[model samples]
Structure formats: structure tokens, C-alpha cells
Target: MAIKPAEIKKLASLSRLVVDDKTITDVTDRLSSVLALVDQLQSAQTESIDVSRPFHIAQRLREDEITESNKIDELQATAPEIYNGFFAVPKMID
Candidate 1:
């Protein structure tokens, strides 16, 4: 389907885009071509296609293991205040 200049103008207005008079025709042509391609894709036959198969191969992942040492004591050493293993902050709500 061909996109009209008026439709393009309305779309530009709705999208808050600044489309000038010169570019409106170019934008309309590009949009129309995209819509035509979409229309062509919609006419494709996919009734017999299998949906169970994955499109990509599975990636090899590294083994899950702890790589860093825990430093909670070292980190909390410089805090102004800590309570029950957590940083203490002033209450903001009444």
C-alpha cells in the first residue's frame, strides 16, 4: 500500500517530528516501500513450518563457581554506621 503525504504529515505530527515540505514526499515514498515489503511478507506461506526447532545453536557456558573473595567486613569498616550486617541510614518517613 502506498503511503500518502497527508498520512505522513499526520504521522509526523503525532510523533512530534519536524518533516518539511521537501522531505515529506521522500518520507512518504520510503514508508510506502516499507509497507509494500510488509505486505509481500504477509503473503508468504508458513503453515508447514516447524516451530519446535531452535533457530540458533546452544552456546557453551563456563562452569558456575565463586571467583571473588567476600570483603563485607573490609567494606563495612569505613561506614559511618552499620546494624545487623547492613548500612544504617537516617529515617526519611514519619
Candidate 2:
């Protein structure tokens, strides 16, 4: 599908995109390229392809493990104020 500058401008306004007159051509070209790719994909013949079978190989995953670090005293020591093991800050709301 051929993309026009006026259409690009309209879309840009609708999508809150800032597109100047000089940049409209560039944006139109990029949009046209994307539409061309869509056309290519739509024209492909995939009726014989098996949908149940995986198209790509699966990746191996690492095992999840839990680890603990006790640094409460170290963090509390640097705070200006602490209440019940938690840092205390000035009240922000009225």
C-alpha cells in the first residue's frame, strides 16, 4: 500500500507524534517499508506447514536457587534515624 504525506500527518496527529513537513517523507517511507513487509508475509504459502510442531528449538534454563545476606545492622548504622529496625524519614504528607 502506498503511504501519503497527508496520511502520515493525520496519523501522527492522532498518535500524538511530532512530525514536521521535511520529516513526513521519511516517516512515510518507513511506514511503507513496514506495510511492504506485511504484504510479503501475507503472500507466503503456509497451508502445508504443521502448526502443532515447534518452529524453533527450545532453550535450556538454569536452576533457581535462594541465597541470604544479613546486612540490616550495616544499613541501619548509616541512617540518620531508625525506628524498630527501619529507617525513619520526615513526614511528606500534610
**In lDDT terms, which candidate is top?**
1
For 1-94, candidate 1 gives per-residue lDDT tens digits of: 9889998989999999989998888899999999998888778798898877557777679889988799999999999999998999999899
Badly placed stretches (over 4 Å) of model 1 are 45-94
How many Å off is the CA of 77 in candidate 1?
A: 31
Q: Which 10-residue window in model 1 sums to the lowest lDDT?
A: 51-60
Q: Which pairs, if any, clash in model 2?
A: none
lDDT of model number 2:
0.87
- All candidates: TM-score: 0.45, 0.43
Question: Against the true structure, whose TM-score is highest?
Answer: 1
Counted clashes in each candidate structure: 0, 0
